[model samples]
Target: MTDTVTLSLADLTARVETIFRRAGMNAAQTRALTSVIVAGERDACKSHGIYRIEGALRTVKAGKVNPLAEPVLDAGEGTAIVRVDAKGGFANPAFELGLPVLAARARELGLAALVINDCTHFSALWPEVEAVTAQGLSAMVMCPSYATVAPTGGNKPLLGTNPFAFGWPRADAPPYVFDFATSVAARGEIELHRRAGKPLPEGWAIDADGNPTTDPEAALEGAMLPFGGHKGAAIGTMIELLAAIMIGDLTSPEVLDYLGTTTLAPFHGELILAFDPARFAAGRPGNPLARAEVLFEAIVGQGARLPSQRRFAARKISESQGVTLTAAEIAGLDRLTAQGLDAVA
Candidate 1:
């Protein structure tokens, strides 16, 4: 038997879709979830890839998320704010339902904000960022996770990892993009390390006693530190304010309280801001897109790599050569497909 198997993206998507469908997810949930999961695999973002399937299934089985949710969009006509109520479903479909209206509002008013409420959130923000960028708009996306990180100068977990992402549209290339958690690393990375029987890197987290630790289990029981100390902590706080509080959704602490366990996916809100660069740069000295290319060239000339370059490279390879999964991963997929929700604890 082979140690690994390579499947075309379509095949992988079909398989993932089947798993979700069999797990009782409705078409909207399954399709949106599958898109983000497959995109994560295609971009080689393993933490956000198929590895997230069980958590989602568990959320559904626990009745914490509505698998049959059909997102509702409020165009917020005549305003710069668009809203989507996820109806207690996953955030992906909510974002999708609001994207077109958000783009339209941004083009008309130079900027717009899409607020996604009452949803369970997983997956990376880059997919949403890229979606906006593809519509010829710059994007900033952020959302709060379950409380798993410590605020600077604090010992206990009080803040979410709080992922934030930005994307700038480009005329002849992939958009310039960066996505990262305010924590030293994403909570999912620690979970992955634990599953793989590997210790986390130093400084990633602290033990319950507030001492630095590399043990993934201890980290899970303890608190993850903010990246860049106070700065990351501040950013995390900002996400809690804008994505959760301002959106009138549950903050990280509230989310954790509501779910009662970190084992399930987070139920919160998301903030996506879209900007039409051309509109913002109207009557400027040079074309905004052209100026951006020049800036990119200068940055590359300095030998500093741009963010998401590696992901885009991996995506190119996956598009042409297909995605490869280890035998163990394939077996896991088989088990999930066969057992559906029973595949998870």
Candidate 2:
């Protein structure tokens, strides 16, 4: 069995931030990226935790991603929509720069959308949605990337994993958060399994010959099946259009084409929407959060655990007990600290 070690949340954040800075990221960029990494770990999301550090360093060293990118926002045509240019950097800073603007616009006009272009998204989508929800607005965020998932009737990959996240405000509890990928499994999960020499579940993927396989390596080499067959495929298609065509950004196929000749971060596009419930529920008896609390209570009374409830619970435990990390991850961090990007540091 693989050995595991634990670290406090504060130590984890400092270590990650130091590594990012050593990789040449500016303070703001480092903080943004580190926050996501720590949040992933806190939520017990192994796919998005420190395992991503090696890939991140590789992308920066190869000049595939700009470590010190400065994102900018442009409100297009009206205040209801805004576009953020991530400048070939990771998605965190771009989302950070655009969220407040989008939240403000939603508060004013009742609804607003933010289109993020040319960014590398390598984490869970829930954080962005949660940020918007914390502002007392409902939110939705989706993004398309390099093709990795096959459509319902075919075996070849034709779409990105295509994550979608939604959040609703609640009065006496944390926001209701739901985030999922259209594929049977996220690409990061497959990568993690492959690294650990583990087998995937049935129906998670098909081999190169379009045959099902439990081998994580084969699954990665071939195509991931959609989560719910045609239904997931349809949602993936809609996300592709909204995140790419609607934003006048490159589609999944286009992103794959760019990746064909370079070891670069696939600059993907993200689409986000924030809604002010007050606009719709104004003068209707109770506010959105109060009504949502009642609904949540009824749902919980029925013994239903809402989406992201497990994650929130995990975060509390992680804070108290510290996060567990594999021996390999600790070694990798040490190598980065000692070597300092001498290769893919």
- Which candidate number has the best lDDT? 1
Q: In model 1, which runs have C-alpha deviations exceeding 4 angstroms?
A: 191-202, 214-217
- After the best TM-score superposition of candidate 1, give how far the Cα of residue 207 lies from its true spot, in angstroms: 3.1
Model 2 C-alpha lDDT per residue in residues 1-345, reported as the tens digit of each score: 659989999999999998989878987678888998899988998767886777777778877678989998896646688889988888889999998889889988899998888887767889899899989899999988778888887888888888888999876677899999889887777888999988998999988778898999888788899889899999999989998888888777778887662234567788899999998787888777777888888999999989999888999899999998889778888888776567473
lDDT measured at residue 252 in model 1 versus the true structure, 0 to 100: 91
Task: Determine the backbone clash count of candidate 2.
Answer: 0
Q: After TM-score superposition, what is the CA distance of residue 112 in candidate 1 from its true location, in Å?
A: 0.3
Instruction: Report the C-alpha lDDT of model 1 over 207-276, residue by residue, as the tens digit.
Output: 8988899999999999999999999999999999999999999999899999999989999999999999
- lDDT against the true structure, per candidate, is 0.95, 0.84
